[model samples]
Target: MSFTNNIFLLMEKSLKKYGNNVHYSVLKEEVLNWINLKDGGIYIDCTCGPGGHSKYLLSSGKEIFIIGLDKDEKMLEIAKENLKGLKNFKLIKGGFENIKEILEKEKIDKVDGFLFDLGFSTPQIKDGQRGFSFREDGPLDMRYDITSNLTAYHILNKWSRRDLVFIFKNYGEIKNCERIVDKIIERRKKKKFETTEELANFICENFKERKKIHPATRFFLALRIATNDELNCLKKGLENSIPFLKKGGRILVISFNSLEDRIVKNFFRKTECIRILTKKPILPTKEEIEVNPLSRSAKLRVGEKNGK
Candidate 1:
């Protein structure tokens, strides 16, 4: 067998070892259709995750080259192993916000599209060890980039009441957080918050569960966002990619929460160098939500680079 085919066979064998669990790319069809990918076009999967979108993009055309990036090495490993057989793709370990530096290093001047899927992959959330979810008990390390110094444990245990209140209020949008923050501070004084279950239980004890979400949902989300500085990174990522996009090239973002959606909406509105393609954000279909309930809140926004 040829070298490429042998690689493909090896990849298939490795995939069997990882099992069938895979991250499903939200709004896959809509994103592909709107990006308007061309033959031999170059694209960037800013948050490649487990390479769901990147794999599809690669399969779309033989000459469609993809530069897949993710801060999480574990996720990148999955992406790499999944696409090992694929040609015309490069996987990089870095923040999506560093796309300018990445492209510069790669000696590429511009790309046809940039795609950001701002949601946790199935592996990240399901793996209790990584601590992205409250469903399973694990450490409070919520850093997407594990090398980062900050973690959910540090914020909950070491941060002051004032800082705790700030994140709960601002990032989690938890109103009337004085009582919750007070409780957190008091508990941490007795014992350091170390595990996801500990925090989840603490938050649950303080606040009743919301309609469909857990009481700890917003708190965990806030901690993850804070630990990773996700909002800031997202803003920078969008800004950094714009200048590198070919004219008429698109930037697509699939954000899962209101905070991320708001940032994307505002960025698309105020940016002068891009035209908003989706006046209203495209939402997941009822069928998609039924299949993957996690996608219910996904909002996809598109912007095309305009000649200034």
Candidate 2:
């Protein structure tokens, strides 16, 4: 086998040995049900993290060709492994914001459906090295594509207090954002923020709160989203995808937080070319949440392209 294939084999082996615990595709039935794919043509998975949704779609025996795109090469490799032996699929290393360019390059005029599952993947959060989670200590790097220059470290240590306050308030939606900014500025002046645990600990120590969730959860989320430029990318991706959808073509978006869901909801509401399919976002079944706790916050919304 080639080196890439060998790597995939090892990843597959590791997943199997560990009982494949890290990944779960949420609201599979709801997504499939909402998207009418009776005569499947071309479907695009915008995020395509580890091929969870794509794998599920392919296994449904639908005669569809899938184009999977992701910014992270590591996730793409894992997706390749997850989708091994699937002939009618192509994987590309790129962000969904460049969907128009990618489709043009591939000579695809339009697509029958699109799937966007927004947020960090399970492996990313669990790995710790990617610095997406506070549960484990790792470098303060939160870029979806590691090749990207900006990192959580830069934001924490180098950004001005004004900029930090903006990020905390707008991105994090923290009520007392200025206080958090003051604390970050104070802490960073003494020593540069280095690791995920260090920053998370600092936030926890400075901002004491009684809540069901961790005090640093929103703070970390804001940093990750800003570091990756995720909101703007989501907006561009949604706008660029509209013109390329075939009449009656479906679009399904699974958002993990209110920020992402609002984007999808507003896009569907304002775009005349598409009609919202679900009146309200669909939530995962209690059973699915029990099996995959990470899926508890997921909300799925769908739309169908207006007929020409």
Error of 1 at 110 (Å): 1.0
Runs in model 1 deviating more than 4 A are 1-20
lDDT of each: 0.86, 0.85
61-177, model 1: which lDDT tens digit per residue? 647889899999999899988887888988899998888899999999989999999967878877888888787689999888989899888888898888988888889888888
Q: Residue by residue across 144-258, what tens digits does model 2's lDDT show?
A: 8989999999998999988888888888888787887887788788899999999888887888644456778888989999999999999999999988999989999999988
Q: What are the TM-scores, per candidate, against the unseen true structure?
A: 0.92, 0.92
What are the runs in model 2 whose C-alpha is more than 4 Å off? 1-21
Backbone clashes for every candidate come to 0, 0
Residue 148 accuracy (lDDT) in model 1: 87
What is the Å distance of residue 290 in model 1 from its true position?
Answer: 1.4
Model 1 shows how many backbone clashes? 0
